[model samples]
Target chain A: MKGAARTIGRDLGRIFQALAGLLFVSILVPLIWGEYYAIPALVVAGLVPFAVGYILTSRFRDAARPGKLHGMIIAALGWFCVAIFGSLPFLLIAWTVELAPPILGEPSQTSTLAAFTNPINAVFESMSGFTGTGLTMTDNEEVLPRTLQWWRSFIEWIGGVGVIVLTTAILARPGSGSLTLYESEARSERIHPSIVSTVQTIWWIFILFTFVSILLLWVVGMPLWGAINHGMTGLATGGFSITDNSIATYDSVAIDFALLPIMLLGSIAFPVHYLILQGDLRNLYSDLQTRWVFIYMGIGTVLLTVLVYVSDTYDSLFTAFRYGSFQFVSAATCAGFQTATDATNVALGRWSAQAQLTVVFGMVVGGAAGSTVGGIKLIRALTLLKGIRFRIADVFYPETAVRRLKINGRRLNEQEIRQEFEEAAIIAALWFLFLGLGTFALLIMLPQGEYTLENVIFEVASAQGNVGLSAGITGPESLPTLGKVMFLFNMWIGRLEIIPVLVTLRAVFDRGGLYR
Target chain B: MTVSDIPIVGDLLESGAEDRVFDSLLLAGPVLILVIAFLGRSTVTVGLAAAYVLFFVAYVLYLGVRR
Candidate 1:
């Protein structure tokens, strides 16, 4: 086959691999649920397509690793297929439950599932889970089966690391190129030459942090299970709280404070932490991205705290600061756990609007390039900031002169800086555009006017940022089917970092095979 | 790909201990506030945590400056 045709085939195969992985993982949930009755059918449903995909990909296994753009294509296609297959567990579970033990007098044989069983709602929940967005399809959280709830948060943990990364690591592939691909997808900085070593190191560090966080939570009087579960989700920056009220259920300032470090660490990039742990400590300072994330969090927290305090929502200034800081980190890391009622309380809830917007902006800025956290990322944010400053300087000077932008003390050429800004701006703009469209569409559908455009915007931004903050507008009962689907899509795209999914789709449709 | 095997940190310290200390304080200060606020579960807990966090943060800054 010609190079162009070969490229097309390669992209398709890659896309299928992602889809298959998602389906495979989704099927595991039924096994976890001990629903043995559903296993045979779920296996058949999931494995048939996967087997076909596996057959197709065997030929392409030796294809030279793809370029960065192609890398994006693989990531995007994988997320889309995963999101679609991720819905299976939701559909099967919801269908089985709604069918409810087969009506007694109706011959109690094998039963058919309901047509409007809200599979889309379940898909939204699953996508949100996998994408690390805490948005939900179900309303009454306490009523949902414990196994499924754990599965949702578990997906958040799994999705934090690319499914391929976990699979590749378990299989123990030590190739540098494979390592590069895995690091690239998870957006983690490479800590070692070999991909497997880097992945293992990252996981090791992540586990260590989680263990420490669990200890802190437990010391603060949280149940051991909640502590462990919260530690896992919190460190991943994937906010899927077990309790319906989120962190609010604890009602302990200690629990909120205990979570603060975990969330903050979650928001910072892993590479920075790795460097710090290595005792190179200077990377912590010389790293522009790390510095700015702290600056951003500091300013945001203080501002939001003052807003909360002045709004008279809480009696004490410390209470205001406590919740304010927690909300900021939650949104900044795109984690979205809330310690206070964000939507209903007119004062603190109202303050959340501003806090949520700031976080949406932060999510676009994101955490460090390698961290599990989502959004545009801090490096891009720093790059854009530097570029903007340089552009302003150029306006004052003559265009004929060379203008260089420096981040942390190193200089980058104008063209390189411009390219960085262009990438960041394009992704950020697209993210907001999707959020706007999703919010407007939801507003048109829902008859209830309880939410303002700001509220809808906040929720959509939350979904897009993969930040879980809600204005009490989402969940299975409140949001219609279409709204849930929209949110789910947003979370998936946001998690994949947008470009990959788009490139993958373009590859799928391009007649000229110009996807690259 | 791994920083553990590389020498990126070797170049970082050439900037000296002052720069390192400054950066650490900058990063640690906000984290401190967050930690205190989080640990203090109530309004009173927040107050106490805030006081403790503030004192520690100030001490860290002084140490950084001294370095």
Candidate 2:
């Protein structure tokens, strides 16, 4: 028991050290922007974890072997701590702005920082950023300082790939614990044999894509700062925007076009990216997940366009297709950017019920597995669909006949097929169960007759799927404390893919639940 | 080769047109409510809701008969 505790501590120490490094890097944003007051806040935040982690690592260095159970616990706890630490910059910046408004050199925006002073709101924003959920507590994001804006986008960029993966790439030496930690982040398939090399390769691809995206956005007429911030969050499939109106504020088709490919690239699995990088175009074309994504996008776009046109939401078929296709791709990829109209504000909120439902469907389906985006995942959905077909076919086949289920050209034996079906069913059931529970909770908490049950379900699904599309329900100021907390829990669960959180909770209450 | 020989396409074709129609309706019924609600057609909403409920009842009966 003592040894186990020590092992947990050492693993936690690695997480803390990673947090400290993130904080240290975060200081550069404020320092460069000449927001000196925010620097001390970041430094203080970094120092606390750095000190504790240093002590823990020195003392418990021997306790280094952490199995799957430890991995889940560490991931859950690590993310929780990172969210708290990430909130420091927001909290400190808010305090500094309130106490000394002139230090930031923007008097008009000083009042905006007061929103972050509330611990719940600050943590909610931080959690949203880190989980790549892209929901914001700030009512008018345009008023936020450049430093905080950069911090928001930066954390999402880090959290998009994953915090544990980042630590493994830069901090962890190759070991059993390192591999377990990497797997705990919901990334099982490695592009390379060595976990370290896989991490490095993923980072390299991520960095290369980010640079290309930024350059493309800048060339398409976005300012350099806007391009950089949007580029990071865009490729991360994180929907956080520096503007009050998200990507709608740009109002440029060129910018929209530039962002679409970046979102798609981010939504694809890293292994696919590596294969494509190795010049395997055939693999890219043949991959089941990729094919499913294209099918979903094609069908969804056509359906959405027709619905929006029939509803008379847009002026013409051309406009309908343009907006419908963009929003569909965005929602499907789980990237939250929306094309805007001058009169309607966010065109998404103004969409008809059928169009909104289409978007919600896309959000629920999400992107490929082993990607930054969140939802049920195409792989799981495919498995569920195929499993049903297989079962039905089995009923028709002769008892003596051999049956094999295939996924992505790989045949699954009896045990593998059963396991796949079980996993898909279990996760899908849990997803809907939680979605229903969250919608019910919101319905009870929200006032009657103001928001429809459909809208409530849509909002809940958006939160749980990490899609960040709102139906006029999820503003920081307007949402009650319970509602905010519920969404926060949903985003955390969604980002971790629901199982690890369940495993962590089970391990906590049942004691030996993980081992059993 | 027949459509039934294709992979995912084959499965869908084998499921029969009746199953396909029912499956699509099952998926789209709730969404139809949202559409009606958004349009603010109260009379249409009532009709749609009644139809949706009836569709479910029929589906249950069909499943029972098939079993």
Candidate 3:
């Protein structure tokens, strides 16, 4: 017990230390803006975590190497702590700095940054950002301080690739059980054989795409800063935006179309990206998850366009296609960028129940498994679908027939098939179970008659999926403290893919303590 | 890797002819955006969109055939 606690605590220290470095680097944002009032908060947020992390690691450095359970615990606890510290920037900036100096852009009458003064809102925004779920507490994103905006995007940027993956790539000591920690983030496919090299390669791929995305968005007429922010978040598939209404604020068909590829790039697994960059572009179609991502995007877009058009949500098929394609890709990738509900295109909340549910389907399935998306994931969805067909076919065979299953490219024997199917089945079952519970809670928690049943389900699915396409139930005013807390908890588990959070909970709730 | 016995996944990774057609559709998505982004799509956009749908349907039908 002591050994487990020691190792988990030590690994968590590394996580905090990495966060501190990121926080310190972020201080440059305020410095550039001459937002001196915000500097102390940034410094303190950095120092507190750094100091705490320093104490823990130095105290526990020589502890036993973390086993997988310890790694899971560290991941769960690390994200929880990171959200707390991550909220400090929002909380402190809102409380300490007034709008008198007015950090950047045209400050609103009531600054959006002020919403963060409430700890629940602060941490809620932090959790949403770090989980790469773009549900915002802020009413107007542009009115927030540039530092806060950058902080939101920055966390999403790192959080999309994952904090553990980043730490494993850079801050981890040579033999500190990087593999288990990496796996704890639900990341499995590696670009290289060595874990460290694999993470570093992932980062390189991330950085390369981020640069390209930024330039492309800029060339398409987004200002340089918005390009930079969106570029990071877009490629991370972390959908935080600096503008008022996300991509809708720009109202540019060019910008929306431009981001489509960026979002898609993010939705593909890093290993596939590596293979393509390494000249095996065939993986684009040949890789299982990659193929399905495009196929889903293609089919979902068309299906959604028809649904929207028939529902009379849009004026014409072309208009329906425009809104449908962008929104579907956004939801499907779990990136959550929205197109405007202009005169031609209707917003999702106002859509027919059938039209809205189509998007819910996309949100629930999400993008490729090894990518930054946060749902049940495509691989599990594939496994579940394939297993059903396998089961049906098995009935046709003889009772003593040798059973086999195959998924993606790998052939699986009976035991492997059972294990794989069980994992997928359990996760899918638990996903809908919690999703049901969340929807039920929100049905009670939300203001009566304000939202439909589908709206509540959409919001819960968005939160649980970590695909932040809000149907009007997320905001400081939108939900009470309990609801905000619930969504944040949902985002946390969703990003960790539920199991680690459950494990961490079970370990804590065990009759025996976390440590002996 | 034997592709025959796999259920839905087998339709993909079926090799040669099927993969080539599907790749065109995959490549088409991004390239179509580039076309619209540079030259704002008018009637040609709608026409291209129609062709895109055709390709998707054809690709599905082609590989979706039962062995």
Candidate 4:
């Protein structure tokens, strides 16, 4: 028991140390940008975690390696800590901006305090940023300080892959429970032989993608600042945009096309990225998940285009197809970039119910597993599909007959197939069940005639799937307290891919299960 | 060979034949209620929504036990 406690303590210390480093790095944004007044707040945030972590690590010098459960606990606790510390800057900046209006820029109609005055709103924004869910509490994003905007995008950039994974890539020493920590983030595929090298490779590729995306966007006529911000969020599959209208503000076909590859790269798994980098195009073409993604996008886009065009939602077929394909891709990839004609109206909000439902389905299916994007990942979807096939095939087989189930050219025995089916079914079931519960909760809380059930379901699924396609239901000022809490919970669970959060909850609540 | 002894389609058919009516009813109950709720907005819709929720919860518990 003592030994286990020591191990847990040591693991937490390592996590806190990583958090300290991240917070300290965050301080540079304000300092470099000459927001000197916020420096003290940032410094305090950095030092507290660093000091506590340093003491714990020093005290627990002889701690043992962590098991899987310990790793899950570290991930859950690490994110929780990061969210709290991350909110400090938002809270302090909001307070400061409220006190002295001209320090950053022109004051907006809404007080800056509205962004963070309620501590829950600040934490919600921080959590949304870190989870790569683009839900924001900032009513006037354009008027916010550049420092806060940078912090928001930066958190999502780091969080796109994962915070713990990033720390594991950079700071985790060799053989110090590094693999367990990596696995805890629900990433099992390693491109390199060692966890350290694999993480490094992933980060390098991510950086390359980010740079290329920025250059492409800038080349396509976006302002340099917007390009940089969008590049980070896009590659991270994080939906936060500086403009209230999102990607639609530019209204350029070239810009939409430019974002496509970056969003695709963000949604594809890191291992697949590695393979493509190594000139293995055949694997990319033949991979089950990749094939399914293409098919889904193609079919969904076409159907949605037809639906929208027939409904006369847009004036031209070309407009319908353009928006239809963009929204479909965005939804499927779990990248939340939306095309808006004006500040308040998004293209998605104008679509028919059937058209919107297509996007919701895409959000549920989501991007590839081992990618930054979230959903009931494509791999699991494939598993369930294969299971259905296997069940159908099993009915005709003799009592003694044995059939091998294959996915992506790899065959699975009966036992493995059964395990896969159960895991896929349970997770998918829970996803839908929670989605229903959240939708129902929103329906109860929202005032009559204000929002439709379809819009509520779309927003709920967006939060639950970590797909940030909003249908006018989610906004900084409009969301109810209950709605905010529900979405916060959704983002937390969705980012962790449901299992770690569940394991952490069980370990915390079930005393007997903790030791086991 | 008999139809049940054939491949693919036969197997699917056999599976359908083997499926219990009670299980099918359990699966369909919530779906039907949800559809009804979606089609209209009234006291009946509210009742259907409640019924759907109850059915969904029970079905999830059933799945947990079966697993």
The numbered model that scores best in lDDT is 3
Tens digits of per-residue lDDT for model 3, A100-132: 454433234355777787899999999999999
Instruction: Choose 1 or 3, whichever is better by TM-score.
Output: 3
C-alpha lDDT score of every prediction, in listed order: 0.65, 0.79, 0.82, 0.76
Worst 10 residues of 4 chain A by lDDT: A104-113
Q: Name the regions of candidate 4 deviating beyond 4 angstroms.
A: A101-113, A340-347, A512-516, B1-67
Candidate 3 lDDT at A159 equals 96
Reference-based lDDT, residue A345, model 2 = 39
| Model 3 error, position A233 (Å) | 1.3
Candidate 4, overall lDDT?
0.76
A208-296: candidate 1 lDDT, tens digit per residue: 46655655676676765577578778888888887767888788888888887888777766666666654555666678877777888
lDDT of 4 at A93: 66
Task: Kindly list the per-residue Cα lDDT of model 4 for residues A66-147, writing each as its tens digit.
Answer: 8988888777777777777778777876676566556445344246445686778888888888888887887557666677
> Model 2, residue A103: what's the lDDT?
49
Candidate 3 docks with a DockQ of 0.03
Which docking category, incorrect, acceptable, medium or high, applies to candidate 4? incorrect
What's the distance in Å from true for residue A204, model 4? 0.9
Better of 2 and 3 by lDDT: 3
RMSD of each: 8.8, 16.2, 9.5, 18.4
Residue A479 in candidate 1, Cα distance off native in Å: 2.1
Which residue runs does candidate 3 get wrong by more than 4 Å?
Answer: A98-109, A342-345, A511-516, B1-67
